[model samples]
Target: MTRRLMLSYVALALLVLLGLEIPLGYLYARGEESRFAQSIERDASMLAEIAEESIEKGNLTALPELAREYAEDNPGARVVIVDRTGRLLTDSAGTIPTGSTLAGEPDIAAALRNRTTVATSTGTNSADVLAATMPGSSGTTIRGALRVTYPMTTVTDRENRIWAVLALAGACIVTAVALVAFALARWITRPLRTLERATAQLAAGRLDNPPDADSGPPELRRLAAAFTHTATRLQHLLQAQHGFASEASHQLKTPLTSLRLRLENFEPYLDPRAHPSLEETIGEVERLSRMVHGLLALARLENTATTPGPVDADAVLVERATMWEPLAAEQHVTIAITGPAAGRVRAIPGALEQIIDNLLANALRVSPPGTTITLARAPGAGLHVIDQGPGMPEADRERAFDRFWRASDSHHDGTGLGLPIVRHLVHASGGQITLHAAPGGGLDAHVQLRPAGRERRFQTIAVTHAAAGHRR
Candidate 1:
């Protein structure tokens, strides 16, 4: 856009220069030609008058000598005398023979008819010439005709010089205009570019600091203000929602606990036929309670800002694997771990643990009996979870990470919130997670995070317990 604006300015300037300078140049040349002709006419008339006087005084020889002197004084000029019957008497430049009948030239012809005339010379010898002719007379008697000619090279040279100056000036003006246009374009667009970056940062949920709204054009400044207003409103709405989810989860847990206790106490007295239905109801209530707790944890993670620090990847994987071992063994499944003893990555507090717990739970839900689940870490702060179970279809991979999404053919009774939670935590910690087909058959989940220099603590045992309780 800036380039287009500057080009538009330069194009308009060029058009204006062409419109103004072309005619100006032509008029200047014409004016110089007219002035040169007028000068020649004046010189011819003066010489003609002198010739008439000399003729009347019977001093014909004096005329030739006067013409010779005039020609010598003014270089590149010619003088000629001719009789009324169109015969040349003398030639100052000696180009025409004396007494030769050569009054056929247009200016000489006009002077023989007793009228002054001015015309440009042409033909082989006329390179560029201005000629003026006048009839020499004495007391109403026309004497011979006098013709004077001057080279027009000087007139053309002056016009060329004028055009050269105009060309230089036009070039300078266009160059200056282009530079000013570039500066102006940048000035107008700089604020817009800055606003664009600020908008992107705001979209990524980093609203702790607002963009400066006072630095651009009036319209853009107003836009910045609007953006800031919208961002503040969004932050307030999210904070309110997070607070409500947290408070609501905490408030509901007490009642849910009471209900579970009541169900347990009443189970002994319930009939055998009614026991399964009662147990199912209790399970549903527990699932709801787990979902609420998951929501609260997600809200907290979303609200929490990730600090720049390292996490103990090795410890996190070891602890999570140990925690899930008892449940895995109950299903006749084994857990395998591989990686360095002290892997490190940049992550928020409790982030890696939450991610590992969710992925491990998700993997356990789908793994077949006696199958081994592989937990491994690689260089570059990468983690992998490979499950020996029926993996989802190719098209369902991305949708699996969406909240409340589950595979249509799956037999597992999952709340379908695990991967979404994992994905959110991974992103918050500046990492990425992807689900792919495992080797042979099953699901493979991969996570890559920024490498950190040293280890730090993880604090997500409460969240893990909450999710685990629901699964059991």
Candidate 2:
């Protein structure tokens, strides 16, 4: 992130430099060219006036000397004087033949025609030259042209010097800007890094204390304060949950112990005449044991760390089905398994098993004789338990999973916590359970489990139980 920010700053600086330098460079070059052109024109105009005055005085002998002196003063300038008939009269360089006709030169020809002209050439001497001409005198038939050639080397040299200074300044400015940008980036990102570390600690459940809020910028300080508040709230919530679980488990222990003791004391007094009463008492003790086990399982689930590995859904279902098979048989019910037998998923193993047990128990109690309680596993993922009992109406389906929610007319001897336990376990395992009406008949409860490891695909297991409430 710091690197990105630095690069962004550099890009912006470059854009600003280009925006300033391009137009300035162009205007500087153009202004230099314009100044040079104007100087050459002024010199030509002065020379033309001097020639006219010299001719009017009829002193042709001093003209060549005057042109030579002008050329020496200007250093790199070439000057020439020509007649109206396109014949060169005086030349500063002295090499050109005096009688040569200047008609072949485009600028010279335009000047001889009594028109001002300027032209640039690049053959023997690569320089821009300006030539202009006007009538030597107004009344007399005297005509002449003045021409001057100036090299662009001096102009180019000046521009190069200016550009070199600009480059040096730009370099220094860029260096300073880069240093400032890096400092600013660090100032911003340092606090963000600290916040990241704090969040990681929180996720790992190692946040025993809050983060220090005085480390960086103002915005980061505020963020750290917010994180501290959130961590405090989470710590309090976890403590409350643990306290509640502890209190509930302690409260339930006495009734469970009493139920066990009563069953034990009544066992030896059983006779053939009271065998039915003995069996009922034994069933009640078993039910109490199940309730205690469920409560303990729920407490452990709430307190324990989340499991990191994938769970085998089919294996869990098959194992729980086998464990409860005898109980279902004793109750005159037939348990059947359906759907894929082997599917993997992510969940806490014991919690998932308990959830399955609770659902099965609920189905067993409410189902009528000869009706099938189906545990059907969906092929792809999740578990579905369908019982063909008097199917719960749609309105009651929502309330079925609430804690201690027994139907008003329910005849089953239960603590009314079966579905609630199932719901808690499912949630702890990162899954969900929904109770709905079965398509054909009875209550259909669906358990969706979290997706497992990459290589292991999820599959749903369906189990069906046949009701035998009317069996002798």
Candidate 3:
């Protein structure tokens, strides 16, 4: 943008220079030519008058000496003297023979007919300005004709010099304009650069360093001020929202636990018919307690920002599988850990453990006995938790990340926040998660993670989380 602005300034300067300089240069050239031609014509008329006196006296002896002296005084000039019959009498520089006939020349012919003419003539080696005049008093009383020729280089050299000076001045002006333009562009854009950095930091989690609203143009200053104010307000709102969710969830836990205990205590005291109602009340309290924890976890996840790092996929799989074996054994189901070592996968701290834990719990809730629940890993393909249980339909899987959404046929008591939490963690680590139908029966929870060596850059996470937050 700076380069573009500078170019625009320079281009405008050049256009203005061309408009003024072109006509000025052309006028100067014409003036130089006109002045040169007049000088030569005046000299030719004076010489013609001098030659008239010598011809009238019939004394030709001093004519050659006068012509030679005049030619020497004027460099690059040629002079010729001719009688009324158009026969040359003397030549400056003596290039032509003494008796040479110049009657065929146009300037000499016109001069002999008692007329003055000034024009330019082009020769093989050079171009010249030729001036012709009649001698021995005008009006067909000519004794001889005198012609003067001067090279065109004198006027052309002057014209060339003026053009060079104009061009140099124009170049200097453009250079100066370019320098000023560069500084102006940088000054105008500084606020935008600061705003860009602030926006990036805000997206990462918080706006620690906001844009400076005191510098640059008035428009940009206003923009920076507005942006800083908006980021601060948004930060405050998010902090307040996360604080409320966290405090409310934590506050509800103690009461719900106490209520469950009190209801269970009532179970033993009540009659047999009331025992069933008491147990139902305790179950509902437990369910409410789990829901509060899920919401608290979500709030914490949204509030904290952590850097992702490499973790051994195979090691995590083995550790988590072993921890879940006892529960599977009690259900008469086998916990099968399979697949090759997947090396290191990138994930936020504690994210992998929670993701695997939630997936395993869901699997175990619906998993049948005598069936194998597989914890598998493959290189580049990431981790998978496959269970031999009833799988979700395509429509339900699509909306599984929506908060508090559950399948209509699901009988298991769940808060329906598991899939949504897994999605947030996966995306925050620059990874992806999806639910697919297992080969024969049950569900496959596929978690795709970036290799640790890859840089953590993910825009999808922000968009996904925003949608999820809105739904919640």
Candidate 4:
């Protein structure tokens, strides 16, 4: 943005300078040429008056001496006298023979025809020359032409100096404009850059810390204020929504408990054949109760602000395997934990546990009898929950992490919120979860976590071994 702004300013300045300087330079050159030509014309006219007397008397002897004297006074000028019949009478430089035909010269031709004339020449002298020719007549009868040739070095030098000055001035102005534009661009875009960074932070879910609105230009200040206002309102609205969910879920448990107690109280009076329906009703009630807890947990997960730290993911896998071992045995399923217990990743405390618990629950639900469920460590601080069950097809796996999504063939006992809750927790803790086909015909639920910096705990085993050796 700053570069564009600065270039725009410089382009405008260049355009203006070009418009002014181009015509000014042309005029300067033309004016210099005109002034030099006019001076030579004036001197030629004066010399023509003197030559008229000498030509009228047909005494051209003194003319050469006069030309020599004129050439002595003006060093770079050539003087020539030519008659009306196109014959040169006397040459100032003494190179051209007297009586040489010279009528082809434009200035001499025009002067012979009774008109004063000026011509610029690039002749044999290796320098441009300005020549002025005037008729020398004895009472309107043309006698000869007085031609004065002056080298254009002085005029050209003056023009060059003028052009140099113009160029220097133009350059200076353009440089000044460039400096001012750069400074102005910096001033203007600095605030805008800050606003851009603040906007990015806001988009990245840093809503609790609003952008600073007190600095920058007035327009940007207003924009920042509006951003802060919108963020604060959104923050409040989300808080209210989550607060309602949390409160509603908490409030629902009491009535649910009371109803369960009442159902238990009525169970004894019911017939034994009716016991199945009663049990089903109790199961539904318990499902509802579990759903309420799930809702509360989901709400809490949404609101949970995770501060990342190192966590032993392998240890988490082992711990979850140990905890769910009894349940797996009852289902005739084996839960196996594999990989190093020292592997670590960055996540919130209990986040890995939450993810493992949800995944283990889902795996246990879908696995068949005598199948093995492997919780293996994947590369790059990741975990894989591999289950040899009726694994999801490609279509169902894509949306498995979506809220309340369940595979079409799966049992209907679950609330279908486990993977979604896990996904939220993993994302909140800067981790990723994906479902892929396992190597041996099962679902591989992959969870890759952000690697944590190695802490002092990583060195503890080495340090302990060293201390033991020293004691021995």
- Using TM-score as the measure, the top candidate is 3
**Model 2 backbone overlap count:** 12
Tell me each candidate's TM-score: 0.62, 0.62, 0.71, 0.67
lDDT of 4 at 420: 76
Worst 10 residues of 4 by lDDT: 463-472
lDDT tens readout by residue for model 3, 398-444? 88888888777666568878888989999898888766667766666
Error of 1 at 205 (Å): 4.3
Runs with alpha carbons beyond 4 Å of true place in candidate 2: 1-179, 203-206, 222-226, 259-296, 330-335, 338-342, 373-438, 441-450, 455-472
TM-score of 1: 0.62
How many residue pairs clash in each candidate at the backbone level? 0, 12, 0, 0
lDDT of 1 by residue, 1-472 (tens): 7898899999999999999999999999999988888888999999999887887777888878988999999988889888666788778988778889867777778787788988876735759677788998765688788988888887989999999999999999999999999998777676676667777777676665565677757787788788889988988898889889889989998899898889888888999999999989888888777777777777777777666467887888888989999999998988887664446777778878877887778777766788877666544445566666666666777677776666666555676677778878777777677666666666666676766754243222111111111221
CA deviation > 4 Å runs, candidate 3: 1-7, 33-137, 140-157, 266-283, 311-346, 356-398, 430-451, 454-472
Ranked candidates, highest lDDT first: 3, 4, 1, 2
**How far is 400's C-alpha from truth in model 2 (Å)?**
5.7
Q: Using lDDT as the measure, which candidate wins?
A: 3
Measured with C-alpha atoms, the lDDT of residue 133 in candidate 4 is: 89
How large is the C-alpha RMSD of every model relative to the true structure? 8.0, 7.4, 5.9, 9.3
